[model samples]
Target chain A: MPEIRVVNFSKHFGKVRAVDNVSFDVKDGEFVALLGPSGCGKTTTLLTLAGIYKPTSGEIYFDDQLMNNVPPKYRNISMVFQNYALYPHMTVFENIAFPLKAKKMSKEEIEKKVLEVTKKLMIDKLLDRKPMQISGGQQQRVALARALVKEPAVLLFDEPLSNLDAKLRMMMRAEIKKLQSDLGITSVYVTHDQAEAMTMASRIAVFSMGKLVQYGTPDEIYNEPKNMFVAAFIGNPPMNFMENFKVQSKDGELFATRGDIMVKLPPKAKEVKFEKTEGLVLGFRPEHCKIAKKEVENSIPANVYVLEPLGRDLIVNLKVKGVGGESELIKIFAEPGMNFEIEEKVYIIPDPEKLHLFDPETEETIL
Target chain B: MAELRLNFFQRNSSKISQAVMIIILVLITSPILLGYAWLILRSFSVDMVHGFIPTKLTLKNWRFLWQEMKGYPNIWRTFLNTFWIALWVMILEALITSMGGYALSRYDFPGRTSMLRFILVLHAFPSISLMVAIYYVLKVIGLLDNLWGIILLKASLEIPWGTWVMKGFYDGIPWELEWAGLVDGYGRFEVWRKIVIPLVKPGIAVTAIFAFLSGWSEFVFINTFIFSQNAWTLSKYVKGIIGDFRFADYGLLTAVGLFYVIPTIVFFFFVNKYMIKLTIGGVKG
Candidate 1:
């Protein structure tokens, strides 16, 4: 059963539409990430799910029960804020036990539950310490314990690891994933970090300019992006885009050409009708481009502009011929020990199966 | 000899700077301190006609004040009345301002921005401009010559400024802490009580001190609205001693002023730590 469903949710703030016509469902135990840059409405969407925000126009359901008018407390959800938001004056024990006390639980039961959560989070030693007395990482753990102690139906996290140092962030990410899996609770995590979203989410919903551009498993998002924005936003070095060339039919065989780079059309590419005067964008991931010693059938000769050594791999920036505009610059990842100097000419052959075509006007993928 | 010369050069410059600072400090504070001492000496002088500076010191003026003048009970009544009015005003001001400030700091409501602007304008208005209207209004309400009237007036006048100070303090408290309480299953009221109020205690102390000092030393409203001898406050009673030129009692008046100032000085000393805490907390939070 779907634990939470947002139906055509749209929230506007004055002249700005923060979340525009967003809709998604969370399965009973699935972990989903609303990933986007700041002001892309990821946090707004999480807040709406937490019931901190009432949608401008939409309906929400939790396990077949409508939650449109429900206040945050009655929604049976717990949220961890970006700042961790541990009560500064309260000891860890009190911070975790507060939710139980609110529910009128017996003092013994509250203590027991608080102790259990503290033990699980490995913060039992710091249970009596105030938040100010503990380190930030410890405080974050206490915040997580406080949220988990309630055993709510859903968990919402708003950039919970953004405040931690890189090493602690990685550690906490693993811990959060393990805890979510163990509890089997539906969770919606919000983060602007693409690496975090890719690593943590069962499926990711990529947002851009207050709209969900794509929602799928990480593999689909990385391999089969639906639009130019998603293709650029999801990858680290980003997909390199070059203008398309006009196709010429000779003896009923189609050939696409741009400068020295020309190739016969693949069976899949030949079936699509290329619109005249409608420009196309060709894209390929950096990792898919390779340096070949021999001239391959569809390889292009390019000059190496810059070489960046990333310890484990080399990022080779190439200047492709006749690609036009700033996108003539293409990135290629080479294995370590592949040495290249500036102005050195090389051959870059992109994998045919990995090539992506987009209609430049609409910015949508062609195939 | 060389080491001695170096020590002399370092020590001489520091000694001169220290001497200059001490001189400036004495120049600023000595007038008030010395005048107060002279008043004490004059109050105990044996001969009033010769003046207190050259005359033998005695308790004659004190005796005259206790036995001959009808002003003694008025002074005592005024002191008690001032104490009650200031005490009640301080309590009322602190409670109303802290709660209102907390709400304004932590909640979003309709007209919140306009309401804040209006309160700021009220705080900026000169209190003296309202004096005549306030007097006539008090007369119509029959609050003139009433003790509760003075308490209510002082509290109402102090609330806007006190609330402004408290609101700034509450604004400095991170909203995350309160939201944490809310997610921990506390309602809004519980969050205010358990988190917001405890965090702003130093602010409450600072606001209380301002309210208390203002109410304690207020003169114009208390004098205008209160005409009854039994309801007079300390400042009003002190003013009465100097009202008539024929029976002016400078020595007695100075002694009473010293008595009134002592409590404020003592109260300030007690809360000095809280004031420092308030400043540091404001910066950190």
Candidate 2:
């Protein structure tokens, strides 16, 4: 295993920059994910790492060797595409043996390595079946088998689970994570699914547009996002953002105020140096807010709009009156057995420690 | 089955249209069917008592099958020449177009779109208009009156269309497959040979069929440039039988024409599925 370093790498397609200047490092045996939405350049970064695309600027290094001018075959990397990309004309055995054959390895060696990898992936019985003859999940496992049989220095995956059904995707996610740990191969995974990144990656580099927005561990990215984009993109229900706020200190406690709504900042905010205070935005997760029947300190008044029951948790959709001259919708996760009625007035009290403040102009985290 | 389907007019109108369609189809196809019947009958009959009716049956008209016709070279020699030309043209066109189409489909370069459009325009210019220029070029190369000259010319003329059809097939393949090959440790050319070419087999089949048929039936180029009698193909041989309209042997002409077309029919039957796939591919693509 070798450490992979991408320094100020950029890839441009004609006049359009598919991947802007970005830098990151993957320590030996580390599983790093480039996470972003569509057209966010996550896949472009992975392809360039695989030597499929040349970087417009900057350098990539495997350990201490420069890989800028290396062709794909010489780069010693294997990729699993989103579509599996198994050769339709080839059986599973041949597809897995392709990389070995390319190296001119002896027939016996190719067969042994292919069988070992296929058995490991639990797709050995399908060795004689063409790609189309198997189910999508089986095809996926075969693709993984082919990629692993090469035993390359680095493994790149471009949303390998995106084509699978949700239940199968969850299963494969665990399988891939376990395999990476067992093999200890340095890997780069690209995905637009935030949960996939948060659950599987040792570290994640979040991308937006064509630039690397933030790089951190899953815990850091979820608990302390660097910017508003990272905060909004990482969560499932998404972080609720309320703009047009005025942050002011009252009785030595920081409070964010909008029209008739006010929220108390967390106690830890006292240590954060505020660059600006007038124009700020308040952010909090739905799970972080609790519904109260009566008004409480640092709570906003709202009327119940709708309720959605999800087995264990109930999502209460509330409408705050006159937050910014229009009723604003808010959501809070409550116990499924709780009694709630439409148009019933309530108060939304957020956990003080989980509150976030951002500057409106830069959209960067302030506290 | 449900019986409460349609109103009276709807059912009656459908029946009327079906009847009308049958009549129209019968009217349109009967002439072609009768013409083919007469061609087969004329090839086997020696004399006709009533108009368009065979009166005597004989195999003399098909003597070209066993011996050369008067004033013509051995029939087998001409057949072999045609076979060689067709085989060579099929090989050349398929080889050139498959490679050319892959290039047009995959590579990105300056004027790529313009070049594709230019190919279409080149194909649009009827080959008949370029006969003079082709003749001069063949003369300059000292290949005039040669079978190879006609083979090369026929392959070149069919290339633009063959290349375009092949390009369509190549475009349907996912780019991810090639990327996977490259990442799996194959160079560009190796990936093309091993991965891409196998996938475009139907496209090559379609191109080869058209090229072979064109070369087998070639007469204008051979007649104009190929002055030597030994180089004549089946198409030229058939033309020679009908050269003297007043005293032409219609029976021998029909027999030779049928012989020339039997291989084409057999070849079509062998690869009929590929032609159907091409149509479906065109529609889907």
Top of the candidates by TM-score: 2
Model 1 stretches with alpha carbons more than 4 Å out? A244-256, A263-267, A270-278, A293-295, A321-327, B1-69, B74-76, B106-110, B277-283
User: What does candidate 1's lDDT look like per residue over A201-225, in tens digits?
Assistant: 9999999999989999999999899
Per-prediction interface RMSD? 1.7, 2.2
Worst lDDT 10-window in candidate 2 chain A? A320-329
Q: How many Å off is the CA of B189 in candidate 2?
A: 1.0
Per residue, candidate 1 scores C-alpha lDDT tens digits across B57-160 of 65645543355356444455667888888898899999999998987876788998898898889988988999888888888888888988888888998898
The lowest-lDDT stretch of 10 consecutive residues in candidate 2 chain B is: B276-285
Error of 2 at B269 (Å): 0.9
Model 2 per-residue lDDT tens digits across residues A243-333: 7778889999888898768899888898988888777888898988888898888898989999888878888988877544687777789
lDDT of 2 at B204: 94
* CAPRI-style quality class for the chain A–B interface of candidate 2: medium
Cα deviation of A323 in candidate 1 (Å)? 5.4
Give the runs in model 2 whose Cα sits over 4 Å from its true position. A322-324, B1-26, B282-285
Query: Residue-wise lDDT of candidate 2 within B1-285, one digit each (tens)?
Result: 777888777879978899999999999999988888888898999977665889899898999989756787778888999999999999999999999999999999789999899999989998889989998999999999999999999999899889998999999989898999999999999999999899999889999998999898888898898877798888888888878644689889889888998899899999999899888783221
Check candidate 1 and list the clashing pairs: B44-B58
Residue B16 displacement (Å), model 1: 8.1
